[model samples]
Target: MEQANQNQDYQAGDIVYVFYRNPHTQDVANIQAAAVVNHPEKENELALFLYETYYPLSDEVAIYSTEEEANQAYHYYYGEATEGVLE
Candidate 1:
């Protein structure tokens, strides 16, 4: 019930920041804008249809629940806070 409520709270056009690292180099690869498209078919899931294309698409979405979480992940990975939202 709580998960369903959270999923309902997010709708199309909401933005989610995804932080990811390079597999080979083990460096901060990119911070991407993951636009929330809809709720996933599976329960308690967020679906992102848009994102910045830096590396090849892998299974690592690195999705965060909020902006603060995203920023924290960014800082942990890149040693700095994210600057601006990606278009």
Candidate 2:
């Protein structure tokens, strides 16, 4: 298992849920699974890429500092319970 780096609280291989939103429609299409690739040069940042390919559309990505925050946002937008991770 990957361990969280000192710069951020997330490991390199840790899995996080991503709430993908449509750019034009401004609607949340679905939740996705993403892995923590690495921390970017910026402070307290986790670089995440999508784990699945669906809808194949551009989306607005929101990175939260905690899973709870992500879950809350997911529910708020999509009315569903989901989660993610951030730095």
Candidate 3:
């Protein structure tokens, strides 16, 4: 039960979902599947693999174990979409 607010540690190779914003279309976002992998530049830490990039796995990032949870959070946060780009 990995909820967005849980900040649970995920094992490497695990699959998770996140509400990702389109880099090009900042205001639009959608649920995307990501992978938990060993951090390339850190020891004993995990990283998220999404959009061909490795993002550090930390509380700053929200991750969900299921699509339903991700979608739920998406609606809660972005509500039907507007405009906001990714960093």
Candidate topping lDDT? 3
Residue 46 in candidate 1 has what lDDT? 51
C-alpha lDDT of all candidate models, in order: 0.52, 0.51, 0.76
Off by over 4 Å in 3: 1-3, 80-87
* Local accuracy of candidate 2 as per-residue lDDT tens digits, 9-80: 565667666665556666435555667664445454456757443221113445444466566666676564
Q: Residue 49 lDDT in model 3?
A: 93
For all candidates, the clash counts are 0, 0, 3
TM-score per prediction, in order, is 0.44, 0.43, 0.78
- Model 3 sits at a Cα RMSD from the real structure of 4.9
Q: Candidate 1 — which residues are off by over 4 angstroms?
A: 1-9, 21-26, 39-46, 51-60, 65-68, 80-87
Per-residue error for 48 in candidate 2, Å, reads: 0.4
After superposing candidate 2 on the true structure, give the runs of residues whose Cα lies further than 4 Å from its correct spot: 1-8, 23-25, 39-46, 51-72, 80-87
Q: What is the lDDT of residue 16 in candidate 1?
A: 58
Q: Candidate 1's residue-wise lDDT over 1-87, tens digit each?
A: 011123235556776566545567664466656677545554645566653323222244566556666666666655754452233
Instruction: Please provide, for model 3 over 10-75, each residue's C-alpha lDDT reduced to its tens digit, 9 standing for 90 to 100.
Output: 899999887677789886677788999999889988899998899978776778887767776776
Ranking by TM-score: 3, 1, 2
